[model samples]
Target: MLKKSVTFVKGIGEEKAKDLHNLGIYSIQDLLEYFPFRYEDYRPKDITEIKHEERVTIQGTIQSESVLRFYGKKKSKISTRVLVGNVLLTAVFFNQHYLKTKLVIGSKVTLTGKWDQHRLSITVNECKFGIGEQNSSYEPVYSVGGKITVKGLKKMINSAMEQYGNQIKEILPPYYLQKYKLIERKDALYKLHYPLNFEDAKKARRRMVYEEFLLFQLKMQAIRKFHRENSGGASINYDKENVTLFLERLPFSLTSAQQRVVDEILKDMATPYRMNRLLQGDVGSGKTVVAAICLYAAVTARFQGALMVPTEILAEQHYHSLKALLEPVGITSELLTGSIKGKKRKELLTRLESGELNIIIGTHALIQDEVQFHKLGLVITDEQHRFGVEQRRTLRNKGLNPDVLFMTATPIPRTLAISIFGDMDVSTIDEMPAGRKPIETYWAKHQMLERVLSFVEKELMKGRQAYVICPLIEESDKLDVQNAIDVHAQLQHYFRDYKVGLMHGRLHSSEKEEVMQQFSNNEVQILVSTTVVEVGVNVPNATIMVIYDAERFGLSQLHQLRGRVGRGDAQSYCVLLADPKSDVGKERMKIMTETNNGFELSQRDLELRGPGDFFGSKQSGLPEFKIADMIHDYRALEVARNDATHLVSSEEFWENSEYKYLVMYLEEQGVLNGEKMD
Candidate 1:
């Protein structure tokens, strides 16, 4: 049997264990549990159905053949003309003189390779003389590293299974297995790697995907349950009059959608239980204002509020904006960041400890040891996905069961939202503030650059700023396209009289902030940049956004870039420059031109690109599934989710032995016990 620890294995040493750690494999349990992403079936092909240029294997008799040598210093090519019955076929080998000795007159051989349709020939990669019909059969393709081949990997895995396969303990109870019709763990693992047929492989895959998602959801739900039971409820008093007075001082009225979301937040905070909510909004939908109102409520109840942002610039922006608004209401707000030093930092830390500061805004620096809150009741985080789970937990530790309100500008599809944020209650601001116009979007070929420039010049004449976005900050050796620097130069040459600002990732944070501030203050007429402006940089005056090589970006990213404009009352436009020859590119451009609804666009994006590519498997923090597709397998997901909910809700199973086994399995996966039930 494979031991619980990997060090007991034969080949793995301490140093090799570290290398496996990089791959998230630290124990023998981990290695045995690691599953393949996909399985390929290599069934034998019939010779009659094989067309020219098709990959196939054929057994045939080799007829008379001769080697023709060209008179030159260059390497000679060998040609063998083989006759199969009445049909004649030719095989050519380049710079391979050894092949001439392998094939003789009147010999039978089996060749496996792709055929060349133009020359009516087959290029052989694997060929053997006098091979039997027993060798012609199906094969399995496996993912392997540089040191391993498909056959070698299969051999090693099979050997390991022979010794430890049946030893795996089942974490799921027999009753639950029967209810879900899941196969045994050992059989599923073996069939998933090497199946008897395609149907068996698919069955194994279904069971594995269901098990992965079920375990993940159960762990999350258990953590939520623990948190709710241990963390005592907050006692914050509600005052609608205070909130009303604060809103009256605002420049504009809140939309109905925004008001509904604010109400949701207020209700959650007033309850005895600590609130764990997620506020999702579109680019221009006033989510920050809602967060500000929540902070106001907390401060009025004699409690402090903390707003944590992902970036330094965003934190500074929120600090200034909130200070300007709350100062008039006699509420003190301070900014704490790494940039503050000496006596000034010490003063802020002292104020935070004494509860003198009602609202504090900063980046991750707010979680420092010296920063203490006297009565922190509300914790709001912007762009919550940018911060890691442990980092957010650390910040929450600064308060006494503080309520958390996470805000995200990126609109997630409903299914994905449920999968990623299962522990938090979700609220969305679906409407934009009044006076924001829908951006006019269009797709054009590269030849229409002059027209696009002319439109930009017209927008500039109207006293509106414009943004030109390129895909890359610097030039890439592999792709032949214009970089941000090159594009900036080209735009400068075209509009020599117009003031243009350039921004890219290569610039320092301070430099980027300066350029963005210039654009926001109307100091620059045209801003040439990369996708660095996708988040947190708000320029309401910029009404035009032209993205170069728009085909290189995903639909969601393109939607965000388009959102940079149309933030003001002025009519805005987004021009997508792409090659018309690409059908997928054209379809993506069409989706952008159709609507400005982020939720709808997200659903369409999930359909166009599979969920893994849509969310980017590496960045999304979603569990990898071998068979369950988030888009195509929605039905299966729903069924499995319901099954997990039912299993966890049964009170009898809470302290049962089987439930304990499930909890142990989750702990083995690094999900520790926590308070809160999802």
Candidate 2:
């Protein structure tokens, strides 16, 4: 059944099959397993009790009707106002001119839809025209839309279920299923797609979530086993004397947390196996210094070390910062970025290959075939989320299982980190460095825009620079938020005495470097940028940061933006200009104003928003679960992890005929990209 392509199903032509492929529904088996993301629970309600932003169903007489049409490239839309019961509501339907005849004046109908208070209207997705008792059942709400409607997907799924649902084979061990108290696989699929009640839907979801987590954890266990079998080169010599001197040479002492994490890293490196560790810390947490120690250890062992960053700006920043720190101790490093080209790049590569340079730092350019290391023993990547597992493996493959140390500024909850990045040992710098003054954060509404501008101008007048962040690089009709170019123009006119600079992802490398240089040199007093500046630049003189539409960002992001300031001894302020209407947005603002602890905020962010919203899914480099949520299905995750670990580790489990489904599930998932367990 798994081998049969979706084209075997009726109506799934070549074009339709391609669309299904884009949605990861490759075969008939995939179609049967494709479940609804949510259920639309429609319960009839009295018209008198309708609240703003509430989804409701009401049976009322349409006392009156008025239609307004719009002429455009698209078909004309009808905006009809209906007097239902005592409530007057505007119902707009797009390109459904035929509905005009069906929705006659003085007709009694049951309408169900979401009411947009601001729009003073509701878009009717469903309406029944008869006064009859109907069985209330949960309606499956899939994520399909546009070219492929939800109704269309439902038809295909129904067809598949009728034709192939009975042929679908289970790939989970019976004993494990009974142990977890999970529902039958076939039953769960049926209930998820067409559940009669909320309880049935939840039961189906529980079974599916546990299965998803179990499969994922099994893959991780296989990966861990693979790592253990593939031994790395001998441990890099940890010269105690050289390390002590390097620590003493630092301008500031490491915090106890930083030191503890550093010890964990060294311990991993001192082992015979390759060290795979993750260093997590907030911005300005001295994580770089800890990574430098690892790099130094690599150098002491007569092996090369490379630090790869996500951006050229960040690469340049780290290159200069590390050079300043390492140069005094007779250590030399070279930069090999995309910009460094021709003879300069060639010479740097030659030196790097010949062991002339002990430390090589740059962006993704370091992973290129030409940039070979003489004896690379350590590889550190900043913002590890930007790179995928295969990319990290490619870098690691450059050397003989080189020690890989991933670094991240965004704090991840401990449980989440274990679930997503459990491949490596996790060490966190929970404490910030000494003497780093906490940034003074303030929340301001749109009414205080003038006051915020005035405060920024005052700070600029004192020769201290300020940063104004916008959510977008350019204006969009779809988004009602401040953009960088528009904000830069406004600030330029508003603060004529001050020089305002602009930066965004769209800018070229040289252009970005020029703008950042100008800002760093105080030649530009006010810098308007997007989140691209969230990590790299260190502007101590910049004392004020004003973020427009602060609610548009996550708590972790707001904290990172706040980190741009407070780098100097001068008191700094982060003004959050926002008027969030949603409960979650209000909570984000309250959390930002309340606590500066990144770990705590990260856990809260995870709880408030799913992991996907906290950080980009691509950034996590983790599998996107169809059913398992890191927060909601945490217990399932833990149970799955425990069982998966035990199953993968036990030779008897893999060999047992009764447990062969365990291997089949792992194989079907293509976990570890089809690595051979045997």
Candidate 3:
């Protein structure tokens, strides 16, 4: 046992092994485990049967060839022209003089590449002369860097596997393999790189996907079990009469869906076990009203409540809204954020410590060491995606076994929710408020910009306001697209009589708050900004949102941005200005036009782009999956989830050697382990 270093394998020396390290491959096991994303099958097309637009492999003798060269002051171009019977195609290589010496005038060669119909050319990626018989029926295309050629990578991997394949040990047990109908590790690894056929490749892919999902599910289940056993139980009891009284005092009635969600939260809060729950609802779906009832209940029990918002603007909004609703019932509320300073911060801290503040709302400033609550009983986080795991844990640790409720306006699909929030309970609000009308959505090409602007102007004349949104802030010379600041300047030029304010993330917090406040008060007729207004800024007067470069945004983001309007009684409109060249963009816009359902839109989004990039890398905490695709591996995910549940519940498994290996694996990863498994 040489411990399996990649350098020990043939064809992979110190230099090549070091190059592989850049791709996250260090040991022989790592190299053997690196799988290809796809395989290219070459069915061997005859020169006479080869079409110009199709990607095909042709083997034929070169009847004639000539190399042409063009030299300029700073650059030169070289092209090779070959004639195969009546078919003639050009293979152009930029500034590569060595190609002239590689291709001879009359030599037999096999070409594998894309066929271009416009120029009647074959951009040859692989060309082997006199060795046409060595070509495989199918080629494995591994993901490679710029300097790493596909052929070179294949040769290196094949050589390495031949030398060290037998030394790689299987970590999975025999019983587990048979139970899942998985192939052997060695066979799967070999077949994945050089599959006998398409069916074999698919089989290899299935086993690997199952393995990754299995490990992920097991880790999540273990963490959930540990938390269930270790977290101190809450003793606070729920009062339905108090909740009913508060609901009765509300100006509007709650929907049946809202009532169902309220019941779920009440049941969880009343239990002795700590509540780790997620409240996901569509935009303007009355989630805040339900949360208000819970907060009131918590305060009525003489316990403190804490609300954490993702942004300062949202924190201020929640503070005012909660104060308005709770103050009428004689409950006090306080606001704390990074902006609150000097004596004001000290005063809030004093009130928080003395239990004078029943409910406190703030940003990350609430998690500071100086801030303390007298008896924090309930913790509610708005836009839970914006906060990390440690930030959430810090807030939870402030109180003694406080019930946690995580809220998000983005409605996640049930399948994705199960994967991401397996450790917490989920409650979704499927209904909107009674009187709110759905915003009319339309998509237009860039040529209709004037029409959209005229519509905004018409809305402004009616004593209402509008919002113009751009994906970027400042205009970049490199990108040929509109920016928010430039758009704001343009709007000021056009609508000189009306007040126009600009806001972006790069602006100072005070400036953003001022512009938002101005917009709320109708001082600014039109506000131009970025996605900073996506969360909690409520301006019921603004009835129109004209989004430029709409193709650059995802469906969920577009939906969230559109949600900024239609909050008032006035009919609102969302105009999507996109480029006509994008088919996917048009398809996404069509989804917006067909339905106003956030949950349905989210499901379609998950299907279109998958879950990894749904929130644009800022929020999605999906792990780096080597073989498993969260979108395509649904069946495997189900199997792995069932297997994890069964394994965790079995008493015999916890005492067995297999369980010891799993524990060691988790401990090495620095994860928590408790005797709940024992």
Q: Best-fitting candidate, measured by lDDT?
A: 2
Total clashing pairs for each candidate = 9, 0, 0
Q: Which residue window of length 10 is worst by lDDT in model 2?
A: 669-678
For TM-score, the strongest prediction is: 3
Clashing pairs in 3: none
lDDT of each: 0.79, 0.83, 0.81
Candidate 1 off by > 4 Å: 4-42, 47-112, 115-138, 168-170, 174-180, 233-274, 311-357, 362-372, 387-394, 420-436, 471-481, 505-511, 578-595, 599-642, 658-660, 670-678
Predictions: Cα RMSD each:
5.1, 5.9, 4.1
Write candidate 1's Cα lDDT for 1-678 as tens digits: 465565555555686566556656566666665566654323434555668778766667777674756546767677787765566778766666677887888888777778776676777766667755432143455544544456644554565566567777777778867977889877888777767677777777777777777776776665555555566769678678988899999888999999999999999898777788999988889888898899999998898999999777788878877887789999999988878889999999899899988999999999988889999999999998778888898888889888899998888887777677766678999888877778999998889999999999999988888999998877899987668999998888998888889999889877987888788788888999998888777677888999999988888888888988887778999999988457777789899999998888888888888777787876676766644676766666666666666766677667778678786766665545443432
lDDT (C-alpha) at residue 609 in model 2 = 81
Candidate 2 local lDDT, 1-678, one digit each (tens) = 656999998878888888888788899878877888888776666555668888866566655564747687667666666666666778777777777777777787777788777766777767778654445457888887447788889899988888777876666788877887788888899899989889999998998898888878888888777666676456887787999899998998989998899889888887888877888998888888998888887788788888999878788889888888888887789888888899888888888888889998888888788878888899999997787767677788888878889899988887788787766678999998878888888999989999999999888888899999999999999999999999999989999998889999998878998899899889999999999889857999999999999999989899888989988899999999999999999999999988888899988988888777777765655567887788877778888888888988898777888777778776676754546321
How far in Å is the alpha carbon of 610 misplaced in model 2? 4.7
Model with the higher lDDT, candidate 2 or 3: 2
Model 2 residue pairs with clashes: none
